[model samples]
Target chain A: MKSQRVAVLILAGLFLYLSLYTWNLRTGHLDALSNHTGLEVSSWVLRPGKWVADRATTLWKRYVFLVGLQRENERLKDEIGRLVLENADLHERDRTVNRLERLLSFDPPVHWTRKGGRVVAQRLGPAAALETVLVDQGDLSGIRPDTPVITPDGVVGRVMRVGLTASTVLLLTDPNSAIPVISQTTRTPGVAFGRGPGRDMVVEYMNVNAGLKAGEELVTSGLAGIFPKGLPVAVISSVERSDLSLFLSVHATPLIDAALLEEVLFLARTRAGEGH
Target chain B: MLGPSWWLLYTFVGVWAQHFFPGMDFLAPGLLVSLQEERRGNIIWLTVSWILLQEGMGSLFFGSTLLWYGCLILAFHLGRGLFSSTSVTLMCLLGAFLGALHFLFTLMIMRLEVMAFPFERVLFEAVLQAALTPILWWVAHQLYPRRLRSDERSV
Candidate 1:
């Protein structure tokens, strides 16, 4: 009688669980509930913890790591002086480009606003099965899902999910991440698919005859409607002719290391005619 | 009051640990501790809270965590019939089982959701989960307030 009771309980529980799972799958109400509540509370906890850690490290570095501060300041000053000169030259070129575009009656370029955010955590807990990082900006900060995240060096990833005060970024090296890219010089287009973390992404569907070469840069082609055009994505590492397939077998290294990212710039597209 | 406070503190620290040690579940040991205390209310509360937190934080579907904790509860019940509930050996075995379960469950869930997953990394996390679960259980068990011990309650 006792054994029968346990068996019956197990069957009943399994039935109930399956029903809940199926219902939740059909309607994402449970997912949203968890995201809003659990994800929010987690961000609340992490933000303060990260802030304290950053403050402590900053305090120590400012007070104790002063051996070459004077020398670094002098070096930066010289670089800034050179940059100011370069900026003036670039401004002149920009004015000429605007004049040429107006004369040709070209469409206004799309403007992307850059908002900075700090990395709060990476792949937290068992549920963080993907290669991802949590950032300190979210829906409230104008970051929606699929917002392109990049650093000065290159593309980072895009916002995968957003809470009110935080968001999860799917890194470029995650298996699920794919981007449409074109070779910088050859103008050859292909889809770059991430293999996994710590592995180079593979570029697929490029014609075997395309003139892609090792060490060539790949930039976003803006075909996906997520990432903007001409943003640097990766550098080609290898290219080979596959006998069985019509496309070239190619791999490229992402310019930015996801693990080393401490900050990122979220790019929000707006109408260029609206004026910044 | 004390029980809720303790769990709150554990959850905070667990989140920090989870951040540092990505892809690992640090709060899993707490469930066992709750089970041993025979606190039915706390067990239900912890399971629901953890499931919500994990589902929100994780990239997988919401039900993965529900199945994970459900498996744990079932395992505990089954294991209790054979061995002492607090036995170190039993804890180690349960940990290993959970480790394997983590890998299998993740793969199955990811596939069902049509998401690509890093099998190699998940496997590594599984091994780490097996090794750490027992140790974490020991630490959590030791830290349990004596006043809150189930044995201390006068029936």
Candidate 2:
């Protein structure tokens, strides 16, 4: 009799849970609730811990790691001087392009405003199945699903979920992530599909004679409607022609290292659609 | 002695631990300890909080955490019939069970959701979960307040 009672209780509980789960799947109310509460609380906890760690590292580096500081500063100064000359040259070219565009009556480009956020953690908790990182910015910071995340080096990923004050970024290294890309020089178009973490992503659908060579850069083609066009994504690592297939089996190394990501810039679309 | 305040502290520390050890359930051991102590109200609260936290952070659907803790509860109850509830051996066995469950449950959920399976990383985390569960349980058991014990309530 007792066993029967327990079994009935279990069945009833399962039924109720399933009903709730189904409702949540449809409405997404429960997911938002948990994100607002649980994800927010975790971010609050993690932020301080990250702050302390950053401060300690800064203090140590500033005070203790001074052996090569002078040499590094000299090197940085020379690089900055070179970059300033390059910047002036680029500015002149930009002015010429603007003049040419005005004369040709080309459409204005889409503008992106950048919001910076620090990565607090990577794939936290039991439910984090994807190769993801927790960024300390969320819906409040205009971070939404599919918002492009990038670094100075290259593309990072896109915002997957937004909580109140934190968001999850699905890294480009995750197998689920794919981005449309074009070769920098050859202009060969293909889709770059991630092949799990720590593995080079595969570029699919390019013709065997596409002329894509090793070390050639791949940039976002903006066909996905998420990432802006012409952002550096990856570099061609290996390209092979398979007799059985019409397309080249090409692999690329993502420009940004997911494991080394500390701070990322989230790109939000501008109101006027002019990104300089 | 375990109390509301202590539970809050445990949760704070557990969150930190979870941050350090990604993809492993740190609070499951606390639930196991709570079960051994027979704290019904605390059990419910902890389970709910943990479920929310795990589900919120996870990429899969919410029901996976429900199934995870549900299986843990069922295993604990069934194992209690054959072994002492406080036995370290029982915790180790439960930990191993949870480890295997993590792999199978994650794969099942990934399949259901049609997401790519992260076979090797999940396998590594499963082994970690198996090893960490009993150790965390030991830590929680050791740190539990003596004054809050049912036997010591009168004193």
lDDT of 1 at A170: 93
lDDT of 2 by residue, B1-155 (tens): 33888888887888888888889888899899888774688789888988888877777767788889998998999899999998999999999999999999999888877888989899999999999999999999989887776557655
Residue pairs in candidate 2 whose N, alpha carbon or C atoms collide under 3 angstroms: A111-A275, A127-B58, B1-B144, B1-B145, B1-B146
All models: lDDT? 0.85, 0.84
Error at A181, model 2, angstroms: 1.3
RMSD of 1: 7.7
Q: What residue pairs are clashing in model 1?
A: A127-B58
Worst 10 residues of 2 chain A by lDDT: A100-109
* Candidate maximizing lDDT: 1
Categorize the docking of model 2.
medium
Give all TM-scores, in the order shown. Answer: 0.86, 0.85
